[model samples]
Target: MKRIVPLLFLLVAAASLPAEKTAWAFRTGINLTPGLVYNRVWDPGYNGSALTVMSLRQNGGFILGGGIEAGYNYTGFNLHFPLRAGLTVAGGDSLTLSANLDLMPGLILGIPASYFLFALEASMEAVWQVSPCLGISLSAGPRYTVSPGYGEAVSPLEFIDLTVGLAAVMGN
Candidate 1:
């Protein structure tokens, strides 16, 4: 009788413990993101006519395309760091093809919604992510022209970007 009682207690204790809701799952998905970039042009007045000084301005555009991301989730907190590289085709008179690279780290709080996962994303980018994949990304951040004369004359421009997009997961 004593042995049976001990076994029953163990079983009850195990059953009472809460199960883990989040696991280390592999994610590969695509996102269609539309965002803005603020850019500042610095011309040291070294290169003659090619060099021009400009003030900071707000540029608006859209980045339409896809990307692949991998991340992990534990409990209600998720750690996602995704590297997105794509193409950006500018709008209006500044019609130019630009290549962008963005390294994003995001965290989502609260219980994950069914069929839909939402989170607040904050990231720093060296280049626009959609410029390589999609056609265009607005001017919300500093952009260095890939051309030879442009990048060499002015270097290391600082830019802050605000991006909004949707991500879809594929496979397990």
Candidate 2:
């Protein structure tokens, strides 16, 4: 399932590409995403009920500030790559300062479906955005906890999180 997800995403991305080549546009928008996040823990030598712990329910919350996006229009769709960083508030007792670096390769289908857009993105986020001057963005995609060191002492932390939030672009 893990391997297949990426393959499917690529297929969708390729199919969405437009036939006509056009100049890229820098776009900025505000979005709100409300979804579920999954949490997991991995221990190298631990076993017997302590080997792995997981939380796969809707217990996580996220908020995006403002973001900027850049992309080109091909055929009739727009292919975009956006970067967003925000705060993550979990339902659990723990509170984490979270940020994500995501490659949101998506298409904004022309009219009729104009107001709607879709994309598949992969992100690598840290505890916070490096620069405060940079704007925040809103995006949705599969989120994975590649490095699990947040709640190390109490649990081995790892998660496949789904997040929805908004971003504000600064420079643009």
TM-score of 1: 0.22
lDDT of 1: 0.27
Please name the candidate that would achieve the greatest TM-score relative to the true structure. Answer: 2
* Clash counts for the predictions, in order: 19, 16
List TM-score per model, in order.
Answer: 0.22, 0.25
Residue lDDT tens for model 2, 125-147: 22223243333444445533322
Model 2 residue 95 lDDT?
A: 18
lDDT winner among the candidates? 2
lDDT of each: 0.27, 0.32
State the TM-score for model 2: 0.25
